[model samples]
Target: MASFDKKPTFAGLKLRLMNSWMFVAFFIGFFLFWEYSVLWFDIPLYILTPPSLIIENGAADLPRLLDYTLVTGTEVIIGYVLAVVLALPLGLAIAFSTILKRTIYPFIVCIEMVPKIAFAPLFISWLGFGLLPKVIIVFLVCFFPIVLNAILAFNSLSEELTLFSRSTGAGIWRTFFKVRLPAALPQCFVGFKYAAINATVGAAIAEFIGSDEGLGFYIQIVTGNMRPDLAFAGIFFLTLLGLCLFGLVTLAERLLIPWHISVRRN
Candidate 1:
């Protein structure tokens, strides 16, 4: 396995900090552009409200947005958890057993090819206009990466190493526990990270189709009321949620597979 110590150099840290500062500066600059457009071009104010105005709306309506955020946040968490639980054992089974993989792989591929959004209404019909649909949607969006990535990782374990272990009289279970499982772990977390990222969008779409609350529902409500600024704020919150999940996955990957090349570089 590859190692990933970034040296934690002062210059590296400084450069990373500068990158973040640049991002913030760019964000502020966008708002400045909007402000200037409003003043200079005599454009429709609503079309290009300055960042301050947008934030004022967020500040004034945070309680409402926060309330909705809690609802959506809950759905994202629940749905992501469900994906992990279902994907883990299932992935292991598919990866470790050729028989199971052959039987299930085709079915999964077929389902994967279908756009899940097309069936959002079906989910609503079957699960009703509640948390169930949102959770199911999240799972549907996320489950594939988990399964596929796990299978790939499981297969990528060095066969020569396994043969050596077997020749040394290590039993199958012992070899798996000592070697294959650890080798596959980096990819397992990778799948989870990607799944969680997509799941946030899934949760929102499901909420849009049926639910009366959550971030998606909030976006729907605001857009209907001609409140694009509030909608953009909701979008901002949604991006934060997804990015936070991805960051957490990255952290977990670092912890679990510090030696894996994918995680070592800062």
Candidate 2:
């Protein structure tokens, strides 16, 4: 019998490298273009600083930026955790119970209808300029997506699957653990990913409304001082923070649902 194994070709190696590093290459190319475009256009620094200057300024002020990042990150973490802890159970309850669906669900919908940002000032007034208000904002932003997704995930079980589980003589808990939970996890992760994206926004907006520190406040202060480079630096860190949060949620999804079609495809 002939050996089936073949040596890797140069083209295959190059393709794999491109697939793995495409985003990094694009990021570097984009910033290089931005840097040169600003220099070529003679754009005023106050209007739009080049990426080079933004990096220089950010490096110089790394400690301060890190401090503000920590503050914002703290709020995001606390709020996200709280939202997940409460929302999942509540979602499950609402999915299973008609009473909750009729009563509490509508109330939640009404609350979610209001723009979460609008509540920042009220929370600040009530909770003061402390961390609690910012945490509350993050919680609100994360809560609805998770709860709504959880409800949808739990309800999405097919009638056939339900009958099959019943026929197997599985108890409620067994059915939930073996079938419902796994099936629902993929959709639940959709909410988690969305909530992760919003968590950063919620914290930053809350800080923007009323806070002495955080990347949002830093950006505002730098902008008022006509330091566009520093403002852009703040934005860069904020973007990094958001990416980190999103990455964590994605990692969790992959770990928990490795057998899922989405995870398998990835």
Candidate 3:
């Protein structure tokens, strides 16, 4: 019998490197260039701290940074979860019901039109410097996209799909779970990815306006104290947090809708 196993070839190695190692190589090269460029230009530490110093300072303050990260992460997770949980049902109702379409939809549109960041200060004042305000801000920022996408997803289902489900004697709930929900999920995930990005920003903006802890507050304090290196470190942490949240949403999309053409293309 012929053996089925094959050794890895140069082409396979090249493909793997191109797919995975390219990003790592680019990140390393970019930071290395940044570090040397700042040194070569004799850039003032206060104005533009090099990556080496940023890493050193951030590592030194890792414990406090982790605390701030936790605060912001909690706000983002809670608010994002709340938005997703509530928006789906509301979107479905709005898509199906004329009354909600006429009444609630217009109000939602008005809310979406207003700048979300402007509400941060008011939320702070109303809720005091608690976590609730930051969570609310995150919720507001995430809610609209999810709702709009859900409505679009539900409405975009073809009449033929519905008729086929009915022809099979599928009940409303069965059709929703088996046909409607699966068809809708790919589009819905687009909103989820968008909301995940916004959740971090909303929390940061809220913290910037008023809060005692969080990466945003930490950056503001360090910047005011003329510690640009520390500020950069805080910013780096904030970005990492956002990336982690976004990664979670992307992972969920992959898990829930692995058969989608968008997921398969990736």
List TM-score per model, in order.
0.90, 0.91, 0.92
190-241, model 2: which lDDT tens digit per residue? Answer: 9999999999999999998899999989998999999999999998889999
For model 1, residues 213-255, the per-residue Cα lDDT tens digits are 8889988988888777788788888888888888888888887
In candidate 2, how many Å is residue 219 off?
A: 0.8
Report the CA-based lDDT of candidate 2 relative to the real structure. Answer: 0.91
- In model 3, where is the ten-residue run with the lowest total lDDT? 1-10
Model 1 residue runs over 4 Å out of place are: 1-12, 18-25
Which pairs clash inside model 2?
none
Encode model 3's per-residue lDDT on 95-121: one tens digit a residue: 889999999999998989998889999
Q: Report lDDT (Cα) of residue 53, candidate 1.
A: 71
* lDDT at 38, model 1: 74
lDDT of 3: 0.91
The weakest ten consecutive residues by lDDT in model 2 span 1-10
lDDT of 1 at 231: 84
lDDT score, candidate 3, position 114: 95
Worst 10 residues of 1 by lDDT: 1-10
TM-score-superior candidate, 2 or 3: 3
